[model samples]
Target: MSKILIISAVFAPEPVVSAKLSEDIANELALDYQVVVIAPKPTRPFGFDLQKDENNQTIYRLQNLDSYVFPESKLLGRLKESYSFGLACKKYISQNRKNIDLIYMNSWPIFSQYLIVKTAQKYKIKVVTHVQDVYPESLSNKIPRLSFILRFVFLPIDKFVLKNSFKIIAISNKMKTYLAKTRTLSESKIEVVQNWQNEASFTSYKQKENQDRRIFTYMYLGNIGPVAGVDLIIEAFAQASIPKSKLIIAGSGSKKEELKTFVVKSKIVNVEFLEVPDGKVPEIQGSADVMLLPIKKGAASSSIPSKLPAYMFSKKPIIGSLDIDSATAKVIVESNCGWVVEAENVAELANKMKLSFKSTKGSLLEKGENGFEYAMKNLSKKNNLSQVTNIIKNALL
Candidate 1:
């Protein structure tokens, strides 16, 4: 069997959404290909170093300057981590260039991809790039004032990777479209492979009959960051007049403390914060009467939240606060799984929350079922992973 090297910034034992997905792909490919994974040492929220050897693959963890806890607000720390991983990856590929048959990479720590791809090109190795988000553009969205300079400096490098890669995989069609148009690449070069949920692990929870109709729970699960609009959720929840309803914000991010501070300063009584253990995600999600999906207006165009799949699996109706034309809103609307309002509109979001609070359990359950069916039909792991494997095989040919 040919040897395959997978490079990802995050992997198993890291408490991030992409880690699980990356782990699944590496393990699956190991059944046919001689697989090796090069990732950072276990750090951040979930920190447990793994044995180097696994069933059909070998994992190599490189030491880096990244903190045990993610430093979301520190640009210098992030750059140090990215560059460290990049240098390590470059050295590994340089020494093992001859043995590797194909290079598979995740698009993150942009510096790492630039280094690895450049090195791979020299070795004449075929590369398949999996794009989780469109960079420079995604970064630009967050910092509009710096966008022009960012595009000037980073766009060329982005184009080089796109133009030189054997194949490019995007997690969503919206992402593919954005990349193709911005990079001026052919649509045919990019393929869409939606993320899949582990149905076995994320089995839906049993619904409990509401003993107290007066107290409804609205929950948001996933990162609490500017892009995620946790503050928007708080602001809207605070403004809403749902006397018997409560809002629960679960998960951690760079903005988690900032959000908590805001809640305390504003004297918001209805909202509660919870630290969700990874194993308990399904349970927490299922327990909610409705799920809150909020995204900043600027970020909606380039990326879809990773939590969408889990939320779908939870079989809970979504109250999506996103741009009307965003890919996320499109999914919620098309699946008929939930309601949508314009992002960042405090009044509108508050109104939606109140409406969901008043909705009957039957109506919410029906919507949740619609979402679950959509997930099974279109986002099944078997189908999506088959697409990925087929692409890899074809690239090898």
Candidate 2:
């Protein structure tokens, strides 16, 4: 069997979206190809040691400043970590060039993806680039003052990599359209392979007949970052007039403490913050009366959150605060799984929350079932895995 080297900035044990997806990809490919994963050591809030699985696939974890659970969130520290991982990955590929037949990578830590893709091209190895999130676009949105300069410098580099790769896999059609328009690449060169969640991992927890109907729980699970619109969620929850409803913020990130402080200072009594216990995500999701999926307005065009599938699998209606035209909003609307409100509009969000709380259990269950059926039919793990593996096989041929 030919060898396939997979590179990602994060991997299993990290509790990040990229990590889970990358781990699943490696395991799936291992059954047909010799697979090796190159990643940085697992760190924070889920610090798991480097591990190698029984399939004999090797995992090479390089040293970086992210040795601790929460590294300094400075720009320089992030660059150092990215460059270090890039250098380590390049060295490994250089030494093992003759043994590797294909390179599979995600768009993360931009420098690492650039280094590995450039190196693979030089060595005449086949490469499949998975476009998880649009880079300079995401970067530009975050720093408006430097947007022009960042795009000027990085767009060409991004074009070069995408142009030379054997195939570009976009996680969403919106992403593919963005790349095609901005990078001037052929739409045919990019294929859509939406992310999938393991349905089995999210078995629905049936509520008891006597379960409390007095309190409605609205849950938000995932990173608490700027782009996540978490502050908006908190503000809306605080303003909503649902006295019997509770908002659960279960996850960690740079803004976790800031958010907690905000709640304390504002005396927001209806919202609660909790750490998600390992292996309890499904149960937690199932217990909620409604799920909150919020994204900042500007970021809606380039990426879709990896949490959507899991949310759907939990069989609960969603209250999505996102760009009305965003792919995320499109999914929620098309599936008829939930309601959508303008992102960042605190008043609108508050009204939506109140509406969800007043919704009958039967109505919520119907919407949740719609989402679950959509997920099972279109975002099934088995289908997505097979699709990705076939794309890799075709690229190798």
Number of the top-ranking candidate, with TM-score as the measure: 2
lDDT of 2 by residue, 1-397 (tens): 8888888777766677777777788877888788888777665443223344446434442222232122435555765766677777788889889988998887354676777888888899988998887877777877789899888987787788788888999988888988999888899999898888878777545533325667788899987777788999889988885888888998877788888999999988878887776567887776688999999877867567877888998888999998898888889999999999987898999999888887788999999999999988877786787788788888888
The list of candidate 1 runs beyond 4 A from truth reads 44-70, 204-213
lDDT of 1 by residue, 334-391 (tens): 9999899998898999998888877787998999999888887777676677788778
- TM-score per prediction, in order, is 0.91, 0.92
Please give the lDDT score for candidate 1.
0.78
- Each prediction's RMSD to truth: 3.1, 3.1
Candidate with the greatest lDDT versus the true structure: 2
Clash pairs (backbone) in predicted model 2? 44-69
Off by over 4 Å in 2: 44-74, 204-210
lDDT of 2 at 52: 40
Separate clash counts for every candidate: 0, 1
Which 10 residues in a row give candidate 1 its minimum summed lDDT?
60-69
